[model samples]
Target: MNSISYFLQPDSILFNSQDIDFKMPFGATACGEEITFNILTEVSINCLDVRLILKNGKESEFKLYKKKEKKIRDRDYIVWSLHFKTPSLPKTLFYHFKFLIGNSNSIFYYGNNSLGLGGVGSIYENHPIDYQITLFYKNNPSPKWFKESIAYQIFPDRFCNANRDGKLNATKENSFIYGRWNDKPMYIKNSKGEIVRWDFFGGNLKGITQNIGYLKDLNVGTLYLNPIFEATSNHRYDTTNYHNIDPILGTLKDFKEMVRECKQRGICTILDGVFNHTGKDSIYFKDASRSTKSPFYSWYRFKEYPYDYDSWWGIKDLPCVNELEPSFFKYIVEGENSVVNHWMKTGIKGWRLDVADELPSFFIENFRYKCKKIDSDAIIIGEVWEDASNKISYGQRREYFNGKQLDSVMNYPLRTYLLNFYNGSIDSETLLKYMNSLRENYPAENYFSNYNLLSSHDVKRIKTSVKDIVKCFNIDTQLQGAAVTRVLKSLSLIQFTLPGVPVIYYGDEVGLEGGKDPDNRRTYPWGSEDSNLLKWYQKITSLRYNSKILKKGEVKFFSPHPDVFGYIRYLPNTNDFIGVISNRSPYKSKFFKLNLKELVGQFSNNITTDIYLWNESLIVPIDSSTDFPIKIPPLKTLLFSSKSV
Candidate 1:
């Protein structure tokens, strides 16, 4: 800790990529785009020279000239800078600053902090952990509508049922339908931990069709439905056939009707593309298992053939696909009526690829090409659970954002940090650091297009995850609901305001509570929703809808207290500064005077201001000074702006 003064501090304003003075063209750079890098260091180090250590494949070095000298807090400092253009292709480049100490002629380096949280880096003697610069293709731009849209994710089997007589749709022989719509989702497994009988609540595509108006009223412009392709399980991640809708859901015609209904109401559809694997019960797999010469035999890898085959994570129910196998590749990507082409022609807006990390880059690139060829506006969002820009999978750094593979990725990093902050696993300040690193790593297009979800079918519902993170059932029912509601409100505020398309899992708006897997996929309690929570969701959604600040404004993060996370969204051309602050402590209330002048610098003293609390919006006076005292109760968040918002 005592040696902190020697570091380059990549996360601070002195080296922050988000700041124009430090890194020109900011966040993600385009191919062949000129980028400027700057670093500030104390002039007392007796530094003789500073060089940039850049690495894409083989490492290279570039010289940095001393740009200026300045006095900060009466201490002398030096600003060193260099300019370089990206290569002809997109690549993720890493860089660090190495200095030659004058008198000693010894080499010292400065780079990213140990944990890579970005802010306030450390000085290194050798082998510095570098900062990332993602270069993306200039031509890959996602649809304008998608980047600006608000999304809703529906786990088909649990969202709704449109049967007039309450009869199940094409009931399968080995599946059971819940007699009641409110029953919690439960897996019917055998002693071997294998699902013996898939269960369903009979939610169909017709259900979504019937509810299109409801989704429209919720201010949802995009509907990201979980796997709708024919799969045996309720989750539908295991695909039996790519061309047909799961019978348990509905017929192909029903799917078309749903898409049509949604389009009529101005909603886009994104279907989950689960190409990494197929169901063991699928006829293709069954036939391949029975015969060595089956046409689909080479589509999968077999350890011994017959009954032994490679499965996804050793889950025998799902047979892993050999994505690069010629036959499989042709069928999925190059076929006349290929899987991607089939759906794209049907008017669906795009695909949300399942387990995107498992699929080969070539396969994804082909998928993207096919989709774009059919409908140029189609968006391709991959399910990459971490930082997508520089993610290393299978010992290879992924080029997802290089502009050929995916339009964007699932923003699991944001979800992870936000949940950790609210759950008390991490403080607000730490969360902000992680978030800043994310924003700095990704290109603006991908960041804005990323699907931001609080809850999804794969994880616990937001309500349950926040309050019952341990998965303990000991908490009283009423107490859990209130606690969940309190945390969710603050979380929703952050989710909607961040620079991405905020997705609401089907029942999350109404306070659905469940933990993991089958538990998390609980049926939406249509009649039992908490009205207040529903209204709260609506309020946040409407606020985001009406404000351009949330959609395109630049973000500046701050933490007035360790337990509170806040940010101001502002457009450079406007005087408006939209403020959002959250107090994540369970019992500790926050009281502090927020100095707008200190944060954003020199705002008009008498700026018309409105502070919006969860229950109400009130006028807050800011006279003669750019500071105002903000007192937030425990488990709450507030929005402030120059407008009555």
Candidate 2:
């Protein structure tokens, strides 16, 4: 007798081979659907009839049934399919199937009797079942408020020229224009013979205030700016004075005016708060390093490393502060005028915490208490790269999702995973599996607060993933730089419509691409704009903000195939919304069928809506039952919402 073999990738796909036949389920093809397995082999002619059985994990409620039995010459082959519904599965569960076939007196044989079948070709040793759990929810949900509300992430200094007279500073380099102040710079030499510098772009509070109308025209409701506290260099991650805005960026008065104008237009302002470390040049550090006798010396730890002292990530420029110090905490969190309280009093709506993982859980918890004391509804988002629920940073556990510390977190894991899937480094099944795992660690409301982003100041732009310059798109050398507007627009659609608060990095809507570090932090291209991609973003934002199903509806994940992925969002109390399938393949109207109703009650033909047309607000009736199959276009996401669920 031939042996049966099976293999599978983790949460990917499963394959099985028995005698002359082979069977497998394509992970991408059978996304949110159920699959059945039935295997049978003949026992000697009527020696106590026995049935072939399959057992999943000890806790799994999975059941199996056999189908038509076949006989060929000396052997009988039993056939069956495995069927069960698991639209959602816990993150930590691992699944394996076992085959128990034979009666009490009947013996199971492998290659030899010396090696018992239990140890040799046993189900555990030979065949490991491939089972993946997924969470289903509506795709591209649009709850009012979010669609019409445009989001703007400002890099502070690089955003505008803060001069009151609008006159350029003669001393400023051709690449940049300095504003009112001479901010400190950390210069470095690049590949060119000349010295490269990390100098401030001189965009300040005054500049942002002047451009308030321009932002309003873009329909922006939220303004997320990088750190504004007194600090050194371009990106102000190292804080010098948390209580004051960097003079180079603007004066305290400038911030007040900007906040006042933004409020009149219903725009909410969120400031970046770097609580993790302090600049070496900061007053706190300066007093500490001066000597142990200094009053602020207790604010930092000064251990001798070689000859001098230590720093964060081994960089002398950034010194880690002692957050555990009670006085230091009082000074930073609740000084004569608390930093958080001062800003809130100035009309700031929220804060985006930098390196939140490095700060102790106690600090964040207390920080939240302080902020809320000022304004209970103030939003507090953390910069975490993983699931905020179980996010671990600085070799310590952070429990921010228990409705204590953070209102939301930057969803970096989702961003990286999506990028990998689109780049073909992974498939949709992997995405579904990881996303389900992430959900396990977070609170339900955290979904709305999840700041999902693809490209930011920390990583390379998305366009670089598809093709190098001149490879994917036709470009005129005179225009210079790579042109992949089509790919960028498509990627933007997916980013904006995904299940979270889509965050737009400054200038990304205009199709700007840059490398890492300083390069990624280039000045916003206020001139040349990618009108096509910008329009695409506007359309998606408008739809997402207006539809409830896309905003707060339940997500129903359809089985994903290598070529396509589909999902539906149902508002049990309202109207249902559908995410017309989308894929990376450049093909239009590709058919993708998955039993989206595998979980039953979540989505069905009973809940119907009109299919939404692209670039328009009108909807046409769509019959999901009987003959309706979801079809998607390459590089596109379609959202449909009806008046009823």
Candidate 3:
């Protein structure tokens, strides 16, 4: 008797298409849609069974039909295909292949892991390793323009200054102005050890309008301002008035001109919507606090008459609003004179909801409805910190990506993964797995439109984060500088190459460094800018703007070693392809061999190829017949583009 050997390769699995044998579309499908899945084997198999595992833990057998027998690279193989209709309703489904080899007593199972690739393992090993696909409501689509734009996040008070008067705005009653533009932000306290007041840098809307050409030079398509509305604080998360621009920042006329100038230069503006809470000094809250009979009184949840009220995270100054209150809802989104409608009437293109998880689904739905009613193309982004697709908040699952609530959420999970990978805490394989999980969880449209960022006003600057990691070990100063620069460049390379709308924090391109909150909000150093870093940013942004493959092409990842991560972004319909690889190890240079036979075969012999490292061109050959080995500096990145002329 001969023994039967069984094998399965999950990476070679294909779903819904016959031409591309390795393409697998996971997560979010429509009901009644005809879906096809295919699996390839090393040899001919007679006794193989595949099943669709439902969310209810029931395994339903799928009819596997042998599609064809073919020879690839001098190896014989068999292709198995399964076609089934997607089940009704919204639920997650997992599937795997079960093999029972010709009366053998043993059963071999193949399933997907964190990387979304195949491995021979148990069916019930550690909570369903099988491939997962989520079914969502059909006809849900995100905005078209948002998915292809390069987003630039500006902290309005620190981005730029057009007046150049070397003074700050002191119009607010209790506010203090800085004497010099390069002065460090002061967090001064009174004798009682309490923060008495805040200072301003006076970067206004006119400044932004004056610098529109700079953004255009960087090819920034979308400008995401932190908050420009009337507020006591510089950051403006606590809003005093939604309808008016902050006096210190600018007036309505200035804002209008800024928006008009940005529009003329092909840049859309995204305003930060702070609807979850209001400043204690705001008119609505002040009126309610003054008298119980006030019309705004019902807009708050008060345990007592005046002082006792529900605040956001126990912050007394920021009172949480009753979003479902008819009066409040009407004021914000429902009525003809609503804040959202009023702002959309301006030239602003979209809104990024502040603390969206705190806002109820109905409020978000109404907001989206009203915005779309006014302008169907207006995009609404949410500040969701986790996986927005299936995030559970307040004991309820959020439908942020189901096409009704948020067009996209900030991609913080990707930021964490990238930072950890570059900081030497995680390997390339782990990074790939986490990235693949995010890719599988999100809907395709939302995935592309995700606000991917490396640093923001809420977090420590990217340069500071990298420098801190290096300083923790007490390394040489020169080595530390080199390592930090390389790591930052490498991370930026990945940020620009990855799928999503890459967001550049205000001063990050100029190599700004700061810790948290007040520190991260440092004034942009105009005269002391790092020329090398700025030039590097210009080159990378140029590459992103010029390459269609980096913007919209499908991504395929390959990691030849644990320390090296690489991916190829290629458009199947077009002949454009981009290869990006990174070396995350700080102590050693790595020679990475990329398997580009299939990619190179797609191009003709006369194709142009160029390799670059931080704007410096490197010498590397473009060959189709053999695998290429490229040496990368420690903690550096190398980008190869077929379209680079």
Candidate 4:
């Protein structure tokens, strides 16, 4: 018996009437557009039929037409194409291509992963390939300004102190203000396992306004502040009031002034929207808890009145709201004085939906619509931990990138993958695969607009992760301070160069280090700061602002070894190209040979002799050739731009 072999070019596959000459747009599409699938194969066959296997165990056969014989890369192949109208409404369509080969009753399957480079397998030998395409109604697009800007995430309670006199206007009941600005956060719990007291460090809106110069100097275009709405807790995920700033943080006047100052500095503000839940102490929730006849009763779900009710992650202090409840929905999203509209009118540029997965798609859609209605340029981002594309929440698929819901999401997948690579838990191959999958899965616009964060209020600081490399590798020794700083610099370079808005989490630029949650939310060290780390951040951010290619260019990866990762950012119609190469290995420095032709194609020959080394701050001239080799120090990253001769 002889084994059957199949050959399919994954690069030749196309969706939604797109062709090799034009790439398909990312994310969902309108119902009326014709959806198409194209496949190319080298196997000689007179009868080849393809079917689209959908989710829920159903299949739709595609009518094959217009077969053409062609040659690509010195190989002969047959191109097969199919088309169908997209289904009406917003729903994810999971599918894979199944090809009937000849009349022999044999089949070949191709999915997203199986259609890529080096993807070949028998239908019976491997699991069927699965691909997903989301179908949705078209709506207003995200503001262009957000898609083209770099963001800075500021945890408000910890960023700065404006008065220098160290005084909080007011503190929440049972909450205490820390006298020492440098004191570490306490995660202590009481006898009943409740956080009896909350702490504040006196960082306020006035403080942020005072440092507008620092932000402008750092080239930050947007500022994403952790919730400043009236809340008892320091983190402010539990919102006590939607209409007012927390007294401890600042007053409405201070907030308005801060926004004004930030705007003058060219920095837009995005507030965190905690619409899914509110603090139990909030007026709305308190009234509901006190009486079933309360106007806000429907806003919450109670198994038995006050004591037993639904809360976010079962934390009784943060009561989860019935998002779709009429009055609640109206107040938060639909009414004339809706929270979304009110905040937008306050000069803040956008809102980042907290725990977007828990919120229904209809809710998000309405919120987005209302947001745009108020300000056409107002951006809406979601706190999605997984791949926003094709993400399923609460057993239902979400339309996050469908152009009607979220404009962008936190790029956590990239963050984790990059950290793993830098921590030596994964090599360059794995890292590239993860990053490429995201680039391929998301819509191009969303990909560029993604909030690419290296550290945030939720995760451990990148510097801490770098210094704790031994824990990642399961070793006993700790990494030294200098080595950790070097590795963090390399990671920062990659973060700023990658497609998406590079988000500098508060004090990450100045080497803030801590573990998870409360610890990650430490006060930004003022006066005392790591000068080298600050300088590196300033230089790299300046580079991003200066280079258009770094912000909006298409990226391609090329590396010679497992320890080294290299990528190029280039625009199609321009000769401008930026090259980023990093050595993740901690033990030895190595010379990396980069094949310019393989990465940049025809433009490789146009590169000038001048090469800029970011780490060394030197510009050296080299031969303008197809291949160039440069030595990279261990745990260091190198960046250079290609200039036309």
Q: Pick the candidate with the highest TM-score.
A: 1
Which tens-of-lDDT digit does each residue in 1-645 have in candidate 4? 122354433433333212233123433456557765556666445436766666633566655554677777776667676666777655666666676767456676655444331112223223555655655556545576787677888888898878767888676677777879999988658998889888888888888999888898789999999999888788888888899889888799999999998898889999999988999889899999888899999999898878999999999999999999999999998888888877888899889999999999899988988888778888889999988887878887677877688888998988898878877778888677667667655666678889999888889988887777734543325555557777888888898898889999988888888898889999999877888889988988888887778777888876578999988899875667888899887778988667666667654435555554455476665665667778888778888777521
| Model 4 / residue 509 / CA error / Å | 0.9
Question: Which of 1 and 2 is ahead in lDDT?
Answer: 1
- Give the alpha carbon lDDT tens digit for every residue of 1-645 in model 1: 234343334322246555676778767789998988888877666678889889989899999999999776777778898989888878898888888866456777877777775655667768777888888888788888898889999989888889898778887777888888888778888898878888888888888898888787688999999998888788888888888888878898998988988898889999998889999878789889989899999988898867788999999889998999988888788888778778888899999988899999999998899888888999999999999998888998999999899888888788899888876778877888888888888888888887898888878888877776523424556666565677788888889988889999998998888898889889889889989888878888888888888888778888877899998887775677688888876667888888767665543333444433333345554442456677788778877776666
lDDT of 2 by residue, 192-212 (tens): 533345466667787788888
* Steric collisions counted per model: 2, 32, 1, 1
Candidate 3, number of clashes = 1
TM-score for candidate 1, residues paired by index: 0.94
What's the lDDT for candidate 4? 0.77
lDDT of candidate 3 vs native? 0.76
Off by over 4 Å in 2: 1-150, 162-187, 190-197, 305-307, 464-483, 587-589, 593-601, 615-625, 629-631, 643-645
> Where does model 1 exceed 4 Å of error?
1-14, 469-481, 601-624
Where is the poorest 10-residue window by lDDT in model 2?
A: 111-120
Report the Cα lDDT for residue 305, model 1: 69
Residue 461 error, candidate 1, Å: 0.8
Pairing residues by index, what is the TM-score of model 2?
0.72
